[model samples]
Target chain A: MTSRRQLLKSAVLGGGAGVVAATALGSLGPEAAFGAAAPDVEPGAPDPDFAEGRIRSIKDNTLLVLGSNMVFHNIRVVDGTSLWKLGPTTFDQAKPGDGLYARGVRMPDGVLAAESVWLNIVNIKGHVSNITSEKIHLDHKGQEVLCHRVAGKSIAVYSDAPPSADLSLLRVGQHVQILGAWRPDTNEVDIATVFSPH
Target chain B: MARSQPTDPPIDLQAAVRGEVSWFCCGTAWGPCSSTGKGACGTCNSGNLQHAWPNTSDACWAITRPDSCGFALSRRTCGFQHRITALCSGTSVVTSIADCGPQTDLFCGERSCCGATCATDRIIDLTPAAYSRIASLSTGLRPCEISTP
Candidate 1:
């Protein structure tokens, strides 16, 4: 299977040109592919189509989730549904206690037919307290976070510079933001991208 | 009440309100979040300066429903720019609305405190590019002020 790190490189390096080409073709014909259409939900109401929470159980191809706010969600995953964990993964990789964010069409029965599901994803801002060969220690508003670096997957973008797969430019005491996959039930995360000032 | 037009004049940044802000990842990454691709506006990127408001459209409001937590929010659609200032560091950044989130009701009255400042209620979520500009990524949430840029 193609790993998510490879996907990230392709999307960042190649997706831009592809998107531009698709947009050009879309302008020439109404039927040209332009990606998914916007949802038709009401103007000021909560979206019934998206759900985020922790997995309570997995039954058949469905996930019973408990939201961070105490709400319950029933999410269905079909063959077309895309699942992501540390990388592009499958539903079988999911387990109870996994935090998730899913987008799909909410069925009339109140179940969400998920089109995409991301597990343990987290984006946070923090101060780089220390950096070692294996991990970067961060102070996030007084909370400690350990960010593990994934080779070929973790990238860094400094200031307005383009993204590079190099982490050598990072330093201690700098404030940075990280986008990564959170380890289930931990204060640690697998780094995907790190944004920092030059 | 009728919603404000996208082309309406920019709201004053100084008069903006206070809330707790957090960050989230989307677009071109490992795992399931990679499929999120561009967010609801088809324009959101983890590399771009963008944000998700509780109420971007009626559909988004239906999901976030800040009102359920006793916080009423305006219907600001995608591409609407809001300038957010980090209260602790006095740092600020301007980000456009890219998605809907923070499920304010889930953490109703939830607060994040730093030093002498504390912010209650989850109000806004930002992209990595935007949040890192004004704060550190290790900090899960920070107190912030929101206003139109």
Candidate 2:
């Protein structure tokens, strides 16, 4: 019989590779959803340098990247060591409008524990949000949804359908229908629609 | 009891947010909900067995006892599942939306839950006694989307 540890190790190794392959394949669906007639690059492009998208959510140290159109990308950015800053240090300064990138291992649960976060310069639109140093929170229909971004900053929307953007624009007293994946592993919602006034 | 092949009924699901969480109207607040689609007909027990179906034109469910209802899945799962219990004609039974586990799946697979999918579109997890208490007056409405969450 396979030893417990050996079995676990094997599962991880297989699962790790499977995750990479799954993300690679999963992104393809969005590429297709966005009407990408054809994508030449391999799954997720394996771009070590950078992966940018709106702030879907931050759980632990993972960021779920909603690529162009509806493509989903899980970015992990966490460093266990004390020396490393580990993931995005400026969680409070991160906002749905701000573009973000991180580097981490992709877990089987469709989340990424990043080692670092890169805030890209972009235009995103959102309502006024009370900011703090730890984390920002927004009121969606009396629901205090958490947010990330610098306090007292300009708001802009890069994509109307961006789950992050839609989540930010939600009215405190209005109803917002949500249809997407909440990858608890990464602590993010791969939002598809925020159900705005069509 | 024996009933002819019936139809699935539709259910209404209410959405609410408590403090910071958003979820559907559940439990006693909302009526019965299950894949069988029909409300509980109060026919499940030691002798009066129920027949249900977890999947149909109804809401999703998670199997709590697959063995009792009868299933053959290799691994146990919990997300959305459904089941139906058949009783006397015009009195088919349905299960409510409930968190199912490995043991539940075992029961479901055996045929303890709803034997076949009901015509109702919602789910009800009420027991036979509870169902008999309120099922007489509660006829489910047609299935419709929440339009808004």
Candidate 3:
């Protein structure tokens, strides 16, 4: 008999872009709206179904993670998993020492069967202290964060408008929220999306 | 209920105050957070619907200093309830003051918007439990509007 996991794997692999779109964009869609139930977790504590840490080792399809609490975790990636680094990506792009957040079901053996993985992602609020031709400097919680613009990959959302490739509206001293991929071990990040109010 | 003290000033505004919203971990242990202890008020928990206000106390005011960014914020102590709405997700949560933080002065003139609704600066920080009620935990920051309930 075909198991649920095997069925999902086949569907995800064969479905291509349509499946990828739903998994990528609707990954965080409101669970309540769909009547989907969330795994119960204690208030204020780290969620058991989610793991946040740096990858220590990658052995084939499994990732050994060293969590922020100094605990260790094993994350298993299947074909159905949606892997996102700077953007929608494949499993091969994953590397050692990269920070990540994995959401999935915890198997009885304690291995996490990851459904989604976001690597080196950092969401930050800051003021644009300065802007050059390619870099935007931000002051985040008194710390200076260097943000590099990836030409084709970078986009901006102004005043709740649709995203555009144009970043000309950004000005010095305007408060903004940046969704970007961290450079790992550095204060720099690669800008993905910049949200600003005009 | 947290009653205003004799020395506490009245907040007389009718419009909702808008600003940037973020989340922090507190109490117990979790992922990269480890433990934030009990926070400034000594009562914060990650699982509770609590938040941090910039102008909680004189020392907190000195650190956050919303005024440095041209915004005047009222001093609300711990346990005071405030309704926070996340502009990005169009969700709202009622949480009480649990600590002090997000140093508004650091990113003084930051602005964010969703459609015609917009907000400026960092004014509130909610616990993991409270923040997740409105926006995804992966989305670390959002534009929001705050009001006294």
Across residues A87-161, which tens digit of lDDT does each residue of candidate 3 receive?
878889999988877766566678876666778876666789999989999987677889999989888877446
Order of models, best TM-score first:
3, 1, 2
TM-score of 3: 0.65
Look at candidate 2 and tell me the lDDT of residue B63.
Answer: 28
RMSD (Cα, Å) for all candidates, in order, is 15.0, 20.0, 6.9
Poorly placed runs, candidate 1 (over 4 Å):
A1-35, A40-45, B1-149
* TM-score for chain A as predicted in candidate 2: 0.31
Q: Could you tell me every candidate's TM-score relative to the true structure?
A: 0.52, 0.21, 0.65
For A1-198, candidate 2 gives per-residue lDDT tens digits of 432223222333465653443333232211121121111212111232223355677565445666433446666532220011112134454545444433333345655433234343211112224534433333432334443432222122222222233234444433223322222223223232333321
Fnat, model by model in order, equals 0.04, 0.00, 0.08
lDDT of 1 by residue, A59-128 (tens): 9988999875467999876554567675667889999988877655566668776656767867766679
Question: Top model by DockQ, which number?
Answer: 3
- Candidate 1 lDDT over residue span B1-149, tens digit each: 43332333323332687888888766554333433566778776664677888877767777676776556667778878788888877767777888887667655665655566776777899875566445544444678888876
The local distance difference test score of each candidate is 0.67, 0.27, 0.70
* Separate DockQ for every predicted complex: 0.06, 0.02, 0.18
Compared with the true structure, what per-residue lDDT tens digits does model 3 show for residues B2-80?
Answer: 3332333333254688888877766553322332577788888655678888878888888777777766678778888
